[model samples]
Target: MKKALRRYWQTDFWREFFDTFLNISDCQNQPNLSHWGRKISVLLKEDPSRLRETCRLLRIQDETILQAPSF
Candidate 1:
């Protein structure tokens, strides 16, 4: 599942969407942080509104982290 999500996240659509989202949300500044804590803090601090907006746009439901369903 994790591997499949990594694959999906590497796809053009997801990559482009992520890039555009970060650009618009001003998250491009902290690209080096590989940890979720830093990423979440940046999201919640820098642009919480945009974070929420992007989350909605990405269709991330509550209490969920995206994972590709097994075949």
Candidate 2:
């Protein structure tokens, strides 16, 4: 049961991230897959610590969500 909950949490987390990235890229007018790919690469290159922080926050969020009573 816990594993399934975590899996669902992970899926939702990534989906939200994808939506946010797409929105921030502002490429709805002229979408370019390659450009988006390059942007992600640049983001990682600029500061990997941000990625670590994101992961840390995700862990905390997962714990909080899991502790809540299921409806």
Question: lDDT of each structure?
Answer: 0.52, 0.61
Q: What is the lDDT of candidate 1?
A: 0.52
Best by lDDT: 2
Off by over 4 Å in 2: 1-42
lDDT of 1 by residue, 1-71 (tens): 11222334326645654775577646555544356456556645676775665566556543245464546
Give the lowest summed-lDDT range of ten residues in model 1. 1-10
Instruction: Kindly list the per-residue Cα lDDT of model 2 for residues 1-71, writing each as its tens digit.
Output: 22222334346645755776567655455446687677656665677875666567778778888998999
Estimate the TM-score of every prediction: 0.28, 0.41
lDDT of 1 at 10: 28
